[model samples]
Target: MTHPFDLSVVDRWSDERTFDVTPDAVHAYADAVGGPSPVFAVVPAMDLVFAVAETAAPADLRTRVVHGQQDLVLHKPLPVGEKVTVRAAVVGLHGKRSGTTATILVRTRDAVGDPLNEQYVTEFYRGVPTDLSVGVAAPRLPSEPPAGPPSAEAAHHLQHDLPSRYADASGDHNPIHLDDEVARAAGLPGVIVHGLASLAIAARTVLAAAGAEEARLARLSCRFTRPIAPGDTLTTRVWADGAGYRFDGLDGSGATVLGAGVAELRA
Candidate 1:
């Protein structure tokens, strides 16, 4: 189905965010995943969400928005201390009949101005079938919750140089990590790290920690509950249950920053 949309006729969210990446932040996240690190690409993968959210017009655009699907291909592992600036622009748009669904194309970049990733997201806007905005029929929350026992989960950490490389790779150039001056300018104790970067580290945690190869992942989803700064220790713990795994992101102090992480594996 085809719908209607215009960039010049919608809202812009380009200069709306700031961040910091600190030395302490590096240690925290790197320690969580593992001392060294393994390359788990997430640049364009998670960045697509940011790009779509920034470029899309929810108020003016049609409703019935449901996250249809997402995909990401990592070029290489991002190093810590790298600068990343995230900017998203709508590259393409197509519609489903009766406004039943629409696909959006977004591209993200890093601070040094490199193509970090591309995201194509689809939402079912317009033509309301029914008002079931709750329960299994409703959308799920974006934030994850604390994990209970260890059944099935993914665990990982970030390296000291990872933030800098990721910032450049993801186009989420928040100063918290790249610019110390910017970090001081912000009210944070220091530069705050990109939540997606942490999320990426968490995404790999499930695989590396569980000793499962990448091919084991069938489906994965999680919520960004808190912001993480560079140099901080981030530990992702995972557990297995039923046909999938439950996971969570933790701070150096063992605080649950991200929760309700789930991953379905293929047999």
Candidate 2:
């Protein structure tokens, strides 16, 4: 079947923008995600990685797509109160039985044109069919969990206002995260926490557990397994794996929220 939208834009969809790493932006992210230290002191990873949202994309498709996965490789911590260039392009479009997934490659560079990080954001358009599989897929996480007990474990409470707070800080004002009605209309239970917000929280906990500084984070990746609503308690478990770590997060109901998580620290 022919795809409803143009598939020719696969490798051609590119966007670029400048992002300011303001002190306020950094602080706000820290407040929302529960950290002004470790993984959040220099800059919340999500604030820099999710800068792809500032890039242009098809407006119509935005409403239909849901964040599927994220893979971020950090070169260095972004400097606060400075500007960085963010460039993005649609690198892959693959069709599954239920939908099509678009893989976007986002690159962040310092003001001097030095590389800072590269992130792959995958969006799944449910019920949208496209048979074409083009370009490169995002990096995959480890298939199996490490055996035995977790090396570190921590839990965080998702405050009722966390969604709004994160929205204000991250510039992601999607109603599904702040409006219960809108979320229900979109087929969600109610107002849910932003996936990146939850991911950021998990990263902070993992880093603190490892006793590593924020700047040491070299790569982070995870698959969003389920929606995490405000007021939910998130428990993250991490296992040491050589130079990196593998982790998983569960919500209050013991349902997995993030799976196949990978976080690596630079030696």
Candidate 3:
């Protein structure tokens, strides 16, 4: 069962999309992720993911996709009302025993073409068989976490309504994050929070602990190790790692949900 979508056209660019980082959109994204600093002039980093999600993947490839991992590098803060052009390309495709993984590289720039941010989004299509002969396997994050007591920690409560709200705000209406039946069919215990939502909360916590502004967030990357149920309490733990920070997210029971988290803040 080869994948319905062609995987050989790597590096081919998709049609460019212009995203206006409006105040309303920024506020809505904040509200969706459970309010961060409400008065931020710089847009939330995950908004770039939302913008890419809107136009990155072809429709036929979206029906059964799951966000596997994400890497974001911000060159400059996206100010409200600025229109950024997003150009995406298929950077890599891999065939695994269970499915195919596709990597989308999204480059965001100012109207004058100054680089604003770069995002690498990985999506897994379960049960989509493909030829392993041609595709390369995506790199894996370390399963082991940093040792010692965390230098900083922050607890967050994911409200029961958050998934639906985030779905609306982020334009990610995957039923697995909203409909219980859909989740059950998909083998999830219940509707789960968006992985990017969890990442957002963790990133915000680290920035706050470092006494840094959201605009100072230069790089963030993480792997989702477990599903985050709506209404679960998440505790993010961070440790200083040279010029960057390594972190992880634990559920109420202390089980790791987001792992191998790394973030770099601008000086």
Candidate 4:
């Protein structure tokens, strides 16, 4: 049977969106992600990435799509109250028996056209099969955890209402992350946390440990390995990997929630 999606329509196709990074927007993100630094200092890494919309896809696949991975490269830290424009293009797509994964390249620029961040966002369409698999995947990171004791560790307690708070802050009102019944219908046990929200929390923990809290973020990437539910405490572990750092998150039962995490900071 042929797949319903054309797949090539979005390939290399691009779109642009413009928005201002107001104080309220920044503060809401920081509060939701549990960032330690002042909310006004620097916008959260994931915030800059998510501010840009993903490249459009078939409407049939939209509801079944979920964030599969995120690879972010920050050229400059966006300050509060900056007007920025984000351009998103579907760079690649891979199909499998399970579903199709579309790799989107998102670029954000300040009002003066200064580069702020570049992100490779992967969206996975569950149970949507396709015979064609083309285009480049996101840049590779270490799949296995570092073989040594973690240099630093931080525990983040996710509140039961975290999903609601994060949904409000990130403008991602997916029912799977809000309504339990909807999540169950989607084959999830209950309302699961947004992948990006968990990623933002883990990124801040890694940054603080590297003592690059105030430094410009060079890169951050992670794959969503497992679902994280609300009211679960996550422990993020970071290891010094040469010049950059390797990290991952584990849930209460010690299952890897986020894997292949990599982060680097500019001097």
How close is every model to the real structure, measured as TM-score?
A: 0.50, 0.90, 0.85, 0.89
Q: Best by lDDT, which number?
A: 2
Residue 252 displacement (Å), model 2: 0.5
lDDT of 1 by residue, 127-218 (tens): 53322221111124335444467744443444566657666655555456667666665434555555556655666777665666655564
Q: Give the TM-score of candidate 3.
A: 0.85
**Backbone clashes in model 4, listed as residue pairs:** none
lDDT of 2 by residue, 170-238 (tens): 777788898999888778899999888888999987887788887888998899889998988999999
Model 3 lDDT tens row, 1-267? 445665546666766777788878877888877666322222333344444444434675565677888777778777578887877666677776777777777777888999987777787777775754343333455577787889999999999998988777766677899899988877788899988888878888888777777777787888777888988999999998788788999999999888898888778
Worst 10 residues of 3 by lDDT: 37-46
Q: Number of clashes in every candidate structure?
A: 77, 0, 0, 0
Q: What's the best-to-worst order under TM-score?
A: 2, 4, 3, 1
Residue 203 CA error for candidate 1 (Å)? 2.5
All candidates: CA RMSD (Å): 11.1, 3.0, 3.7, 3.2
> What is the TM-score of candidate 2?
0.90
RMSD of 2: 3.0
What is the descending lDDT order?
2, 4, 3, 1
lDDT: worst 10-residue window of model 2: 37-46
